[model samples]
Target: MSDGARVIVGVSGSLHSLTALHRAAEEARARQAVLVPVLAWTPVGGERNYRARPCPPLLRAWQELAEGRLEQALGQAFGGLPIGLPSQPMVLRGEAAAVLTGLADRPDDLLVVSSGEQGGLRTGLRRALRRSVARQCLKRARCGVLVVPPSTLHEDLRALHRGIDLRELAAA
Candidate 1:
């Protein structure tokens, strides 16, 4: 496939990322473009205070794991080989947001990613920090950016619980 005629989706083996991949694939098919699934990974201990950087072996291991996870996510998204549009898996070694943003700069390429983590305390903290990957892409992307949010059922459930609590508080 041509370099610019591609729909790139960032995957992390999570349900949200897989959903983004599925959406990206559909977009690619609609646009008559190729689908490129990218997973960015970095070693946990890299640039630690005690050590300047992680060893090569550790980096290699992490890269291998990321590649495996990307493969699994691809399988989950397309149920094995994708039909119609050409699909490629890319394992990048760097921060997810930066890597995705860099790819988004490519001309005529569409970058897709999950908007944010599903509801959780950790995710809430990340959102509070304004550190979401999708937010970064939205800010910096030169190409088309699609931030695929989680299903609305999760939001509906949250609203339902909040409404019940609000009613109880009002009664008090």
Candidate 2:
């Protein structure tokens, strides 16, 4: 919200999301910017269709669950850091791709997300039918976008935990 640049990373309780969080934090550190870890969710179709406003209690419960998950993700991703960085955890109520893509409005802001490499055939098929977050951001984002692909044999999770050039990761 301030004039300072922001490194916005979309996150979930997945290996790919954790990788994105770590990379996003590194970019924020390099740029001396703020890091924002965001988790977005929408109610299941049944809940959305059954109620006019949806149950207030249920919505609150969902928020609490999402917040807990985000907290866990941040801890897991940056637990071993030598120093703290300016970071904010956000739980947004909406679709993940839309919310993340919307955050790329500022010129200096950078957005980070992961390709669903861990996702198997079903997920791939769904993404093929409906664009994944990375694809949507590439098409719609206004600022820089870094999409960390599903790490392969050469560039795996352990390697990611150590460190990888954000630019190089983006380029891959």
Residues 5-58, candidate 1: write the lDDT tens digits.
Answer: 989899998878887888998999888888889999877844362167547787
lDDT of 1 at 16: 82
Q: What TM-score does model 2 achieve against the real structure? A: 0.79
lDDT of 1 at 120: 82
Task: Estimate every model's Cα lDDT from 0 to 1.
Answer: 0.81, 0.80
In the range 105-164, model 2's lDDT, one tens digit per residue, is 888999999986655587778877777888888888999999987656425554576687
Best-performing candidate as measured by TM-score: 1
Deviation of model 2 at 16, angstroms: 0.3
True-structure lDDT of candidate 2: 0.80
